[model samples]
Target: MAIVTTIRRDAVTLPAAELGPDNPLPPLRPLDEMHRIEDRDKDDLPRDMARQIGYEPLRSLLPARVRDGYGRERAPRELDALVIENDRLRATVLPGLGGRVASLFHKPTGRELLYRNPVFQPACFALNGAWFSGGIEWNIGATGHTTLSCSPLHAARVTAPDGGEMLRLWEWERLRDLPFQVDLWLPEGSDFLYVGVRIRNPHDRPVPLYWWSNIAVPEECRVLAPAEEAYHFGYERRLRRVPVPSYDGIDRTYPAHGVHPADYFYEVPDGRRRWIAALDEDGEGLVQTSTDVLRGRKLFVWGTGTGGRRWQRWLTEPGTGGYCEIQAGLARTQLEHVRLEAESDVAWLEAYGPLSAEREGEWPGVVRAAEERLEACLPRERVEDAYAAWRPCADTEPDEVLAVGSGWGALEVLRTGDKLPGTPFEEVTLGDAQVPWLELLRSGSFPEPRRVGPPGETLVAPHWRDMLETAPARPLTEYHLGVAQWHAGDRAQAVRSWERALPLAPSQWPLLRCLAVADQEAGHHERAADRYAEAFDDLCRERRDDGETWTSVTAALGREALDALLAVGRTEDARSVWYRLHPVTRERGRFRLTEARLLLAEGDREAARAVFDDGFEVADLREGAGAIDELWARITDEPLPAHYDFRMRPAM
Candidate 1:
């Protein structure tokens, strides 16, 4: 005979020991152990493993005020009965996704549906039953292609108490045959409904358990996340048009800041999931109540988009806001760990839908809990709302409600009109026929006719043998051509071309620098030195305005340029430039030490030591100056040189 029993009539008692701490996203193993449920096997699992779990686990971190009217803190009872909703008799459907029956009477168990009627691919199983094939295996669960995991067997059913008719069962074939309209429901008017799931770590070592919930928010509403406080990789390009905010709320301030508003992912590690009042502009709120950081299993948080071509939208269009993805895991990056020897899985997920329009008097003391949770995910005082368009009220009118949070409200609004404009860098249009002057020079194809006699015959000997004297392109282009000519062993022609380019071309730093080098190559030492001197002076002027301290690399480059100028017979110019930099160089630690070497070259031993003694302030100069001091000591035993070879270098 089969054992028969009715729903236990006795008031259900929970063992005090089973009730874990009142926290967001509580662990599922405690409940599973109490109910004697088998844990889920770590075989091929789903991608979006984080999405399989609901958002309820994060609720425990909510302010006590907001967590009110939810479930009471209770211990687990020995012999727990996992209740399953069997039919749609009392189920209620939400606003979107028509015909998808939801168990309205049953308070969400906080346990989410993981693999329902899963169909396996040749190698894997579907995690979210959408795009990805889950983490481990790629199983196809579409109609007519039902697959099941070989290990950690799962069973589902829709039935009344013992001896009652079966409502439904977790069978792939059966679910396919039945309409998607079917839904499981909790008893009528139940304040809280509890569903349990088992996480089986079949492996010898522990694997991570991850999950996420698909909570739908209104299109008009926005999301908030603490990007400045949290490590955020800007917007997901795949989900651009998808509805949702980039970040979850940072805190309960008037307006938020430091978030990119587009596709961005926010990861909260285990023991870090906590936030309060995920509210919309119209005041729709979904607060996190608890989180179960399952040991050895990482929790993933995700915000899905309703519609878009890519995973994230808003790279090109900042106005296009997408969903916010809030997740908890062992690591911050996409996927952290999985061992062949470990057992890890995402267990439960619950979504509390659109709350009452007016939530009054802070739910209950959940503020501290919520604040703590925020601390785990981000630093204190970092939470902020999403970026949105701001509209100011008329200044002429003295309004009452408008003045309440107006001071903050004004700052909350993000201005969209001030984006930096892009500039086009194409050549000015002359005509469809554009001349390729650089190409002409490279090809050596001068269009000007060759010297010919009066009879139009090629002259055996021409009055002038200069075939190409004028440059065909812009002055800078011609300058480049001159450099190429010098490399090709045509020094005279190169020098002539450079002379033409110098005055015709505007003084762009790059061009001026290049011209200076060209003059040096042409052996016009005086001209090269003058060019370098002019360039260095200009750079100093530019940097002086910004008060930017010069780096060792930059200072070295500048010194090298100065040396080059002095080498080219512009010693007086180099000295003038050097004097201007002396005060600034004295302020710099490394430059001051290097200045000592310059002093030694000038036969000023006392001056060199003065700088070396005070050069400790120049952090980069200490080692070299120290080495020089040691060498100086050795050299003191012998007669010091009248003048040291302090190689002067030019400034870049």
Candidate 2:
């Protein structure tokens, strides 16, 4: 039997090394140049789209208003890199670089538990661009790395309640009007580093937020977790299933599996406390265990194949070995949104450390050893008690217009009339006015309707039109009205509304896309093609200016533009727009299929076949065998496979 040692707070003593001026790491580059994408064209697509819609570009829309304090460039300064250490373990924090954990080292084995990039190399992989591929990156906000990932955070060195040293990193999330803080502590003699995160909504209304911790590790590691299945979206954002960690009982360790590069979000069973570890063949590596608040674990691997190698190069500098990510999420999966109510905050703790096996055949013993230590560090009772104490109080207000609450694995919003049975509601009789819940939700606004209940999708146009007539000249309002009109099938009215909205928010990519769609539907193919091109260009500019990356919606709009250009016989323009898309987006199987279709239409069967083959490779990577079969069916004029859904359009 193997002996397991549990560390306690009182038994440990602090190490001698201190985090001060004398032990600073390299200073970050200037903010202006840090996140910028190079070789981008100086085309103002938003301005051109605005002109096409018969409006001038709005000055107010030069930079996104939601992102406060983001447009201005900060002066270069030498920032300190803080470190917390014990006799066995050491952790470093880079405050200037999103306060990321720069390095986690195990002294006895001289191993780096977390991948440490040699320099701050910002790449265009995050929703808000500027993502560095090493260390544990804190992502908070809608999706991807939050707007704060590349920005400097306020830092402080404090003493924990048990007299342990801690490094606190904090900042206001300007876009969401929330304040978030992270406290990192390395106890005196423990081999683990603890992380505590708090995100508080300070406003009167509720805000939607998403958060994930992306921890990078060496590619030659095997993830150990007790999940039976993994979920990922393949072509067209359709959900696809695959086995976790392995497909055929054989462990699909990194760089060893025949599977294509893909994102894997494992579904953890309910009521189970899960711990995830990424260990090398020698059974030595990092382990992450968290409190109940974090319910999901994910793996992102850019495989060792050609496409994977290309992506690895795109994310990091040359000669830097590729890495795999072990991620943890606040929700059941990535891309799911949660709400933080007014004055409410969510808190959770995560502990990371080194784990090693006693012998090669005793790898499971290492997992058990880590789990025992983690259980001792953060007992289930302590976590539950902390949650009970910190959980938000229920809302008792009767007249609240939009009540936001979170439970049952989703963020739920209730209007007065939409309340469930047994819930309290005001008796005052409000009129027959309805609210467009979906539209309002998408627009990031609270519905101000006279009555409750859900509104009809077609009725959204009239509501927004009425609001625009009486309300102030709000660009967002006008934009909402245009979306409503478009959805309601009032194409001309939608175009007109977008025309009015463009002058107030020219940089709004969705408005440009809406206009382009309207034009395309109206048979103005040339105009639509030009507008689509403009929209894609404008999105690229917005990313370069704001560090935003390609979203599914934006990617769809780009595809639409490409199709429109091809329809108008503007093949060159279509090709140019296709090239402008992010390399990640362009590598998708759907986009490759589109390219192949276009080549085939242009009477180049050989080129089309080659493109189709390339797309087939990508499809294989995405586990999109169904898509490959569909493409073959289209090329050979044969019936699609029986399981394939013919009615469903190909993913944009």
Candidate 3:
């Protein structure tokens, strides 16, 4: 049967909890998770590896806001999806959900190659929070999942290298302020799907670049990659070189062999063709390979442990099957960031399809068979040749725009007058968030908010910061300038800018919160607490039209204030903030956990225990976080309940 590939608009209705409005608060915390690399066998690492690790550590998420407003209460919501299909396969992509390839179906085998998430449950997994599991997720920002994890992407239909219509998703990543696009196409009647990714550094200065294409396959599969050794990074916060296929006296190829969550970053030799595969017992499954530019491949296993299983359940529905992730990145490890030269861009072509291998064959032999079979099925040259064919067409203007993402990209393009031919950030895509920045770009003046409320989103890129520094000194300008200064590592100047902005600010909460963060960073806990309290008070006093949404923001701010208050031994103040939260907000699992913490801090152990007795699930429970179990153990020297035990580390 002859096949013709096509793209169409679609929707998937899942029991999804909506991602409520992002917290207007700027992310002031320095990311310390990457710095926790254990000292075990530290001498084995490169001479300057640890020293270089300090470079490009995520300082703050200034332009992006934290997305913690989601709750556990899910309803059937229809998510906008884009579908691309041909004779042998069908792929469903959620453009609104970070352009996640939500499902890939193999027609001949009647199998789903990717772990299609049964539900869309936003968790605190992404960099800016609110990430869902499963499918192929593109991580473009530093070390963590991209801030766009639960956000939308601009999508359009473009002419493929093979003359078929391909789906392209593009966005301006605010973290590094780079524009990237992913072009996905399947040749007619071919089992393999080709993904061409390009990330451009539009500025004259060099920028740190990070990109990882994460593919989730069922846990029943045995993962394989051509590497004699792999770097094992665990929740123990250590990276150690371990022998591949025989780590810890077991064939670590299978995801089910372990009892703790971990990452096995395959040390694929310099000359090797980069690939990773996960095959079932019958040795038939998906294999992903890319051109040499993407040098790294990794297998992430959420092992058969309590915490891992709980996380699997939390991501989707409990009854659904669990899965593991096989990833490819530009750097050897996710912890590292590669440098993109000024005005240069990196492009790569990736191929995803099915492969068959000897099911019961020995360690290296089965992997070798899979490699040989893959070569016979779809040669590396074919992928390379496809990449060559797609290069010129990459700039082919979209014939039709299917979905619109944030206006930030359009704003950037307008400011810089970047002629990004193929991936156009059209003026029509600009919307509310980009309004003030647009005004700033059009006229030399940055407009202040018309009402006394939380400030809109902030942009801290060097260009925007330069503009803010030169703009007229108003509260909004000063506040934004302070943020840009802090992002630029001018700590003292940032503090001074906020101090100048606070008193005359229309709404004082934003500036006060920034000051609170600064004070906390400087080890002035009492001063931080005082400022947090003031910020929370000012927010509560405001009467706004966006009552429920404002309440959500207040709840988020209240949590931050409560933590600072607790740090200074102000339990009563923390209690006051907790009680001030709306009933709906207070009922959330996150707030319930906070309430329990406040109770414990107030010396009411039983009260905290009772809060736990009413079992609740923190929808945004962080990866490797076991706070519930710790709090439970504190109240009573009891074995942690199975449902509550979310520790991903070794039992030792």
Cα lDDT of model 2 by residue, 1-652, tens digit: 2112212211112111111111010011111211111122113222332222222111111011112111111233343566667787777776766777878998879999997765454443444334557889998765455655565665555444345445666655543545666766665666777777787664567766677988999887777654667665322343346665556564553534634465677777777675677878787889887777887888776655544565555445559777888899876556455667776778887778886632223334544565565567556565554334322211111221221111110111222123321122232311122234333434545344343211112223244345444544456556656655554456677678778878767465666776776676567888878788887777666644222223433455666778788877887887787777767657665577778767766677778767754433231112223444555665766553332322222335
Give every collision pair in model 2: 127-549, 128-547, 129-547, 236-651
**TM-scores, each model vs. reference:** 0.25, 0.55, 0.97
- Across 90-119, the per-residue lDDT of candidate 1 in tens digits comes to 222211111111222212334221211111
**Range of the 10 consecutive residues with the lowest summed lDDT in candidate 1:** 386-395
Candidate 3 lDDT tens digits, 1-652: 7679999999999998978878777887733343246445556776555544445768887678888888777999999999999998899999998999999999999999998888889988888888988999999988878899999999999999989999999999988899999999999989999999999999998888888999999989899898888888898888888998876688888899988889998989888778999989888889999999998899999889888898888788988799999999987788777788999999999999988887565767877887888899899899899999998888999999999998888898899887998998889989888898888877878998877767778889888988988889899999988988988889899999999987788788888888998999899999999999999888888836357568767877888898899878899999888878888778888888888888889899999999988888887777777678877888899788787878889865
Model 1 misses residue 25 by how many Å? Answer: 40
Which regions of candidate 2 fall more than 4 Å away from where they truly are?
1-88, 143-147, 157-159, 163-165, 172-177, 203-208, 228-245, 253-255, 317-319, 339-343, 358-370, 373-498, 501-525, 530-567, 571-652
Model 1, position 354, has a per-residue lDDT of 24
Whole-model alpha-carbon lDDT for candidate 2: 0.55
Per-residue error at 12 for model 2, in Å? 30
